[model samples]
Target: MRIIKWVVRLLVLLAVIFVGGAFLLPKETSVARTVTMNAAPEVIFPYIANLRANQSWSPWLDRDPDIQLAFNDVPEGVGAAMSWQSEHPQVGSGNMIIIEAQDPRRLVTALDFGEMGTATAYFNLVAAEGGTAVTWGFTSDNGNNPMFRWMGLMMDGWVGPDYEQGLNNLKKLVEGA
Candidate 1:
């Protein structure tokens, strides 16, 4: 009886520790990927400007086949907005709006995920080698949410690969176009 009581106590302690750790994790993280396209910045800006254009190469779009997405404002430049709703946890639900644009060069957007949180995404196109080098980046601050502290650790690994894949896909599509 004493052994069982000790075991129960230990289990409770462990649970408390785990919960505490989750609540204490860092809330900010970033992921970035770069790729070069044979096409000019003009050719690539369209893809970055319009969320609708993102369907051609966005890594996440293919993840949830049934996700409902809506776009508004300009179809392919500053002022564009895209929002999505999905039942899948992997897809979650969010909206992103174009907050900055330097035609054929730099594009920046603000993304909000309600309970999931908010983030900033950037796309930069620079001349490199024989083509344009495009870099995609995302960053978010969790505002020290107790439950979201671990997100920063998981985010780099989680988002990095997807960013790389998205860049590669963009390269292929723009090169082919």
Candidate 2:
């Protein structure tokens, strides 16, 4: 009976620690990755602005080759969108829609990650060193969910590598073209 009481106390203490830790975590997360491609922004824009071309450089697509994808009628620019369904947990399911764009300079997208909620992503293109420097970024707010807020703390470590690989792939494709 004494041992059972001590075990219950220990479990209560651990739960308190977890809840307190969640309160200390950030409520938002942002991650950005950049790469310079040896091609003009005009040369690279199609690859990003066009949903079909965009998939060619998506790192996640490589994660689940068998995943199904649905594309909108408009292929590029502000209205372009794509939804993907994947049985892989890491891949999950999501839809992305281009919401704002400035020709070859910038593109902003809205991403809906099913139960994980939504995020905003941006692609900024600028002329640099006779080529284009592209920055890919995503931002999300965890709202009032303590668990999600805690998870936000690890978002950079979780998503940064994928961003780096995607940018690298984009560079290779545009430069090779």
Q: Which prediction has the highest lDDT against the true structure?
A: 2
Clashing pairs in 1: 25-149
Give TM per candidate: 0.84, 0.93
TM-score of 2: 0.93
lDDT by residue (tens digit), candidate 1, 51-90: 8889999988888999999988578667899999988776
lDDT of 2 by residue, 1-177 (tens): 999999999999998888887778777889999999999899889888999997889988988889999999987999999999999887899999999989899999999998999999999999888688899999998887778887888888989999999999999898885
- lDDT, model 1: 0.87
lDDT of each: 0.87, 0.91
Candidate 2's displacement at residue 10, Å, is 2.3
* Global lDDT of model 2: 0.91
Error of 1 at 113 (Å): 1.4
